[model samples]
Target: MKEFRAAVEAGDFEGLGELLAEDVVFRSPVAFKPYEGKPIVAAILRGVGRVFTEFRYVRELADADGGGSALVFETVVDGVSVNGIDLIRTNDAGLVSELTVMVRPLSGANALATAMSAQFDQIVAEASGASS
Candidate 1:
């Protein structure tokens, strides 16, 4: 998960993409369905980059076998204070196979949902464009 942290901290979206499995799954805190596949997940991450401000990871808890991890983070969305955790799991190839995001405070989550909703079209476009 060191690579994941480095990529996020550096704001390196391409690097982040390289760390994902082709069939990676993303579970969002506000979404009902889990988004699957690398392209969509990468696009979602990019959309998140646009929505969140002052994002920073505060702590990390990893399995001793390096199979999974939980990264604690803090950020702000439209001035709403947000606390979150990124639950990541790796596949046999050592690339991220699954990522589940959990956020706290109803206000913060609502703010995030609203902000992401505004960019949903653009995110889908990017994912489709990337696939094409």
Candidate 2:
């Protein structure tokens, strides 16, 4: 999880990609269906990097079983403050296998959704281009 935090804090998408499993699953706070695969998830996170401002992790909770970790963070989207958590589970190889994100407050969530929605096309295109 140290690697994940470091990569995110540094806004290093290539490094982030290196830490994810090939078949990693990503659960978005605003999306109903989870996105799969490293390329796509990396692309989505890239979009997030573009949308969020003043992002920082405030707290981190590690699972007793050494299986997962929850990272609590805060950021601004469209001038709205958003509080969120990233639930990350790793495989035996220490590569992120699943990532679930949750955010709070109606206004912040709506702002996040709206902002991300605007980037969907670019995200999909990047992901597809990477896979190709």
Candidate 3:
């Protein structure tokens, strides 16, 4: 989680992509569909980099489930803070294969939720382009 957080907070998409399994899937409450594969993950991370000025991983709990982990973090957007958790599952090869993220703001959960949305279209567009 720390390594992944470092790459993400640094906006190192290239390096981040290298960390994912090709069949990776990222899920969130805001989106009905899982953000499938690396392209979609990159797009969402791109949008996250745009919305959050600062993102840091705080805590993590691991080795507790069917080969999965949970990561907690704080992100700052326009100076306000928000908390997020990523429930991630990895394949037997130890490569991350799935991620489910839940984010709540300290002072602006609703606004953050709205803003966090409105990016699915971009995600879809990126995924489409990648598949082409």
* Candidate 1 stretches greater than 4 Å from native: 130-132
CA RMSD of all predictions: 1.7, 1.7, 3.1
- Which lDDT values do the candidates have, in the order given? 0.92, 0.93, 0.72
lDDT of 3 by residue, 44-122 (tens): 7666766776677778798755578788888776567888888878888767788888877536455465676766577
Give the TM-score of each candidate. 0.95, 0.95, 0.77
Candidate 2 lowest-lDDT run of ten: 123-132
Output the TM-score of candidate 1.
0.95
Model 2: residue 38 alpha-carbon error in angstroms: 1.0
Query: CA lDDT of 78 in candidate 3?
Result: 57
What TM value does model 2 have? 0.95
Off by over 4 Å in 2: 130-132
Total clashing pairs in model 1 = 0
**How many backbone overlaps does candidate 2 show?**
0
